[model samples]
Target: MTQPVSKTSVLAGMTSRALVIAALVVIVAACLPMVLSSYQVGLATEVLIFGVLAMSIDILAGFAGRTSLGHGAIFGVSTYVVVYATGQAGLSPWAGFALGVLAATAVASVFALLAVRTSGVYFPLLTLALGMIVWGVCLRWTQVTGGENGMRADVRPAALMSHSAFYWAVLAGAVVVSFAMWRFVRSPFGLTLRGIRDSESRMRSLGYNVPLHLFIGFTVSGIFAGIAGGLYAMFNNFVSPSTVALAQSVEGVLMMIAGGVGTLFGAFVGAAAIIVLENIVSSYTERWLMVLGITFVLIMIFAPEGIIGKLRAITSRKVR
Candidate 1:
């Protein structure tokens, strides 16, 4: 009754769909500055930063199958690096960004070295404990981090002062980072990581150093998280201990899970959804966290694999 589709036809359809989506994203992003207010552009910047953080989580959780609960600590360390280097040390913002990345990478390597030795729940708990220690240091280290008052950048860089420039910069950074991550997921190392994720014992038996691979992945993810944190601190011109709180780490996990754990685009979608919902719901009451928790539970019960995953499943069924 129906004509069967060939492999060529399916490939062509996928390519065409991807192209259309790419074009749409470009068009929308290009037009947003013209249509939206500067405040809205600022909000978009926050979304992009959160998207980066979410993607970092995806790198570990989705690809490497490593559940980390201390990513917010890495992010906070970067933020503090930027603030301390640029604001207090009187270095250039660019130098601050580099230092932030270095700091995050160093911390991540140490964390991975210790955390990767364990698997499952212990790994996450170890990271969480480490993150809390970092938070405690930030809170108590008054001379360096400004304690509860937080640290502020003396000035915003010239390039980021303009709303349009900042918007474009953030958008470009997000796109480039996302593309790099996508490529990483398609590489040999990425395939090996997936293999490790599926069965670490099997990978070890195959002569792969599982801990080494995880450590590398963790460090890479931390570098990206640091970059995101640098952008966030620059945009806000402030860094605080609260930025590295356990709650923030939990939020990152939630964003990745809600978006679609293994899908790259899902991170962006989840960040956008969470940001928009938070903004709207907070306008009504301070109990938005309660609402958010309930909503998350509902989604977990109804769409465990997430919105994108559910859509993909539906599409596959239709094709079948």
Candidate 2:
């Protein structure tokens, strides 16, 4: 008879595989700027920033079973704070980055307090309402946010002025954020999150403070999203009301879904696919939105498990 595999051995094998894949990714990212044009490098940077946002979404929507539509608000709050601190307050870039992250964490905390008690559809609805509030604020706050005109600030330091340099910086940040998130999701706390997601009532009966765990998870997600926002602001050197719009939040969720909801690194794959396809499609057509919708429909219909999820399933089967 075949012996049952030990969990420890399985975990060790998975860790080794992950390390190898991470090394390959880093090497590829390092070489990308050397081959791509300036515009392409900028697009790659956006992918990394947006990938981080999607990964944050994964932490909430994937692990915690709490989908947040207000994450755009949390993200945009960071961007606006960074711009205001660096441009209006004339603070250094590093200081502004810190402030931006703090603002995002604060907003996320407020959101968690209001919505963490709810579950299922109500949580998403509450988050959507909160997101709309932020969008309206961005529209009406004429002085600080610059209203519809938005805010512009070049926060890049002298060392990262070149496109390649900026790309490398963003890549490094992405790697760090990804590593931290990977560790978080593998920790015991993360296991509690998954347990909560699987059965909230059961976890509660097990003496877990479900709401508190959710709150902490949301805050952690916000921190990652805020990091992405700070990077994006530095990349674009501008922020507008659209940054806080519902569509932004929707797209982040979509990226998570398309890449494989619970798979952390899938966010990068989905971000790269969507960003590159959007750019390519927009270059040829005026109705890229329709195309994007159709593409989403196709993905849902044909690959419901998402690109990475499907690949993982196939790999597992082949290994068996």
Candidate 3:
């Protein structure tokens, strides 16, 4: 009585569905500033910045299988570089951004070279130590960084005109970075990285340079994080040691885990959820970190695969 769906038809349907969803997202974001306050738009911009940071973490943790607990250091270093170059050295903001990315990438390469020698918990601890060292430098080096008082910048370039314009700029950056990351993960190099993740011994047996691949991945991820950090500094017109704290590193990990380890959409969702929840919780009490900790624990225990992964599982089961 009814015709079955052909493979081509099914694929087209899925593609159409994705386009519809993407269109809806853009429409909503474009209209949000009209209905929301400037403060709300500013908060949304922060969430987008975190989304970029989370995606960088995902590239290492999900694709390269290298879990870094020190991304906040890289992030902080980038922000400081931007502030120092533009604010102190009198370079253009664009030049400062490029230099920041280069610095972060170079640092990541060195760190990865040392870190790739270790594995599992040792790698994470190594990164944690690196992060703490950076934090200490930021705190103790008061002259350049302004120490605990932090550093501030003037307004961003004219491209970012209003609060809404800045929000859109951040969102556009997030989308571009996300797309590039998605493409990287779907490439042959990405497959090789996955091979390393699955089995370093096997990859080496096949004559693949496992450590080299990881180092490259780490460096690339750091560059992306640097871009996010530079944008954050510009958006807020400030940077501080607190921005690179251990808590911020943990937040990046939490965003990745909460969204779905290997899924790109998961990172965005997790960033949004965490930021929204933080804003709400902090309004009621200063001890909001306690609530966030408990929430993370519960999410780990109950929704271990994350919202996106779980949704996929449900959809797959239904289709079957």
TM-score of each: 0.90, 0.91, 0.89
User: lDDT winner among the candidates?
Assistant: 2
Q: Could you give me the TM-score of model 2 versus the true structure?
A: 0.91
Model 1 pairs in collision: none
lDDT against the true structure, each candidate: 0.83, 0.87, 0.81
Q: For residues 1-320, could you state the per-residue lDDT of candidate 1 as single tens digits? A: 01111222343343667655655675587568888999888878888888889889889999988878999999889888988899999999989888988998898888888988989889889999999999999999999899999998853588678987888877877776776777677678988899988999999999999999988888988988888888887888898888988877877777888899988768888888888888898889898778778877887898778778888899999999
Q: What is the C-alpha RMSD of each candidate to the true structure, in Å?
A: 6.1, 5.8, 5.9
For model 2, name the residue pairs that clash.
Answer: none
Check candidate 3 and list the clashing pairs: none
Off by over 4 Å in 1: 1-20, 311-320
Number of clashing residue pairs, candidate 2:
0
- Candidate 3 per-residue lDDT, tens place, 1-320, comes to 01111222343343667655655675676677889999899888888888888889889899878879888888878888888888888888889888877877777777788888888889899988988888999999999999999988763777786899888777777766776777678788989988988999999999998888888888888888888888877887788898888878888888888898888657878888889889999999888779878987987887878777777889999999
TM-score of 1: 0.90
lDDT of 2 at 150: 94
Pick the TM-score winner: 2
What lDDT is reached at residue 128 by model 1? 97
Model 1 RMSD in angstroms:
6.1
